[model samples]
Target: MTLTESSQSLDELLKPRRLFRRLIAVIADLRLAIILLLSIALFSISGTVIEQGESVAFYQQNYPEDPALFGFLSWKWILILGLNHVYSTWWFLSLLVLFGSSLIACTFTRQLPALKVAQRWKFYQEPRQFQKLSLSTELKTESSSSLIAQLEKKGYKIYQENQAIYARKGIIGKIGPIVVHVAIIVILAGSIWGALSGFLAQEMVPSGATFGIKNIIEKGLVAASPLTKNWLVKVNRFWIDYTPDGKVDQFYSDLSVVDKEGAELDHKIIHVNKPLRYDGVTFYQTDWGIAGVAVQINNSPVFLLPMAQLSSKGSSRIWGTWIPTKPDLSEGVSLLAKDLQGTMLVYDKEGNLTSAVRPGIPLEINGVTLKVKDLIGSTGLQIKSDPGIPFVYTGFALLMLGVMMSYVSHSQIWILQANECLYIGGKTNRAQVSFEREFLQIIEEINEAQTPTLSVANEIKN
Candidate 1:
């Protein structure tokens, strides 16, 4: 057989059950766990190292000299293995899936047996067995039957007799690990789902501006929606508070949501950390501001005007319509025609007329150059949405609860008398030492009940 065929045969020999065992062993082995963890860490570093979601041309322009190396590291290989985004990497996700599967298998294999043992209330008790118990005690009485009767009266069910006795308490204490293991799977699944499908992003809603999901990043299979149809979100107003040093202290945006059908749902004011949620979309107060540029041109204060100037302001500004004004009549320049470029007029009143002067360009007229003086540059805001956040959060909550329940177990005991010997025992799924102490206390209480006369005698003698 070929080497490939041999390898496949070997793999076939280690199918499902053996593979599961191997995964379990790896997960259980601290070394393998650490190795997998380090692998994940190293892969995650790649995501942070390389810029994500850039075009092919961008990488080519940036790394022209190292095309092969760049291709090997970039989206080329990332797309094949999903490593470009490490968190969503198929192998990484499979590792998590396999880890959970291993946990389930381990729970079934080892923990289930332990649980069965713990659930059994019938413990084989011989004199030798009771003698070797951590909490064994010896009691001598004239009548063993009377002692056993007393123990029965105290509520302990007696099983077997003669030289020793056996009893059990609280047999349900073995489910803690099972619960914890299940919870871990739940939490892991929830986190993975959140990473894959849950979207988190922001959008800036300027006052009176209506926008849609176009501002949100589309990942997985989320369809690209127009900036208007996803959701008609409007910012009614926005405000910010700042410190004396101009550091921002707090900010808020008053927002309203309009559905695709143009129906208003709810209006709310959102602040930092205090977000406004609507129809699975959550609006957070990321930032706010206004932006515009101040413009100036020529020696005169520039203002927008139509092709024809209708009136003159401040003696320098002129506005008019229908009648074409001759620049030469007013300023020793002859007017030829006027278009969008500006008035076409000649220097020296009637000599060769020059070309039209534009608004922002410099024109040489009698040794004077008219230049555009200034143009000033405004505010930026950041925004986001995650429709599946609630599901993710719910999953997280369940995971925590399951973990706690699986780790903490409830166990208690009831003391009773069967034939006159005190029977004491307790059970718990956690903190066996604590339960043991409680059992010891119960034994002491039984002794006190049986020895009250002796205690009274001692007290009287004292």
Candidate 2:
């Protein structure tokens, strides 16, 4: 290749490299980082305000088509924008990835380089450098050794070359931003990992029933395998406690984790705000309801009847079931229950109220003697698994530590000895007034020490 062509080729190659450097510089800018942070925060707020991971029908009902919510949002818009599952959406995840990239870029381009500069030691070679300092003083001293001792006593990391000395303190303050960036990266990684691999499922298990996880309401792409092939949980028993006003105070479920061989691995009695955890899975007690009722007819075998939740139109809770009193598919009565207290209201086939009976009560209905058995209750549980929570918490802890460390002032001092004159100057990244006061105190001490030396020299001369 010709020399001119080769030179042109090299310049072209350098152009792209220079462009890339400029881009990195822009991305690492503090203003840019603040803008990106605020943007991420705004999107996160949107995700929280607009419900996530809901059924299509639910969105359609809540955010209708005609009026639309806030005159702009509708079910179609929500589905199209992936608002139903915002955190797991491609755009939202991409935003997080971009923010993490920004953090990395800033850490490498700004924080680490600043720390390196802070760690480096440079001797003051000229008096002009001292003049540039915010706090500088010219003083006469006997030797540099005494000043070195004072600097050491003040906790400065001293570096000496000939008669010039350089000292710095609070270098950790320069390292704090790097730690903060690293912590933010860790938290972002944890959040992405959890969103990609976590699953949320709900189960309404009747007491004394053993089942596997089958009812998955929300799940990520990789979450299905973990849930479908996991352990079995059994509801040992479910009950409720009532207060003085006959209102339910708490509901509890005795749950057990059983292995494939039916051996119990763990057990716990869980209620509201209390949960059972085993093998990375957590089961939370969220609700309770009536599952079924057991009843016996005169001289007949006992039978269990499943109860169905009745629509109350926003007034009260009720569950109902029909029990056949006769064998010819006729002469049946309706049973209604309101709570776990086991009080059941009976009605005839014609919908007329018959009687209210409790458990172990005998009632004569349709010329048949009937005895009420136990009312079975079902435990509503929400199950979830997230492997990244530990990382997230650790990241937050580090973030707080980094913030505290960043508060320390990074201070630097330079000492120059030239032609029987001493020049000293100091500066700090923060707390300017306090640093000024400290510098003045050091000057005062040097003046006091030199005054006695000057007095002795004058007496000897006389």
Q: Pick the candidate with the highest lDDT.
A: 2
lDDT of 1 by residue, 48-83 (tens): 876554455665555454555545554355455554
Off by over 4 Å in 1: 1-85, 141-173, 200-205, 216-218, 221-230, 293-388, 402-436, 452-462
lDDT minimum window of 10 residues, candidate 1: 372-381
For TM-score, the strongest prediction is: 2
TM-score of each: 0.58, 0.93
Question: Candidate 2 lDDT (Cα, whole model)?
Answer: 0.87
Question: Model 2 Cα RMSD, Å?
Answer: 2.2
Cα lDDT computed for each candidate against the true fold: 0.52, 0.87
